[model samples]
Target: MSAKPLTAREAYQVLRDIALGVRTMRRLGEKPLTGVYSGMMSV
Candidate 1:
């Protein structure tokens, strides 16, 4: 069966939820964090 389409508001809310989850995960250090270095830096 085909799924029902979501309204614009619903779609926006879904995306917002995903962004919040990602931020939360970063805050919790559940994923490997990365940072950018300036100038010649050693790895």
Candidate 2:
């Protein structure tokens, strides 16, 4: 969201939001968000 890097808490919040959104989408029968999880793990 910015040119600068996120702080640890900010990063955590962002990731948590993504996970929640992914879960919600899952309930709606969307595809799994392995790309996002894998990207984070790779980093």
- Ten residues in a row with the worst lDDT in model 2? 22-31
Clash number for each model: 0, 0
Candidate 1 residues 1-43, lDDT tens each?
A: 5558788997677668768774231133344445543233211
Ten-residue stretch with the least lDDT total in model 1: 23-32
What are the clashing pairs of model 1?
A: none
Question: What overall lDDT goes with each candidate model?
Answer: 0.51, 0.53
Candidate number achieving the greatest TM-score relative to the actual structure: 1
Residue 11 shift from truth in candidate 2, angstroms: 0.2
TM-score of each: 0.46, 0.45
CA RMSD per model (angstroms): 11.9, 8.0
lDDT of 2: 0.53
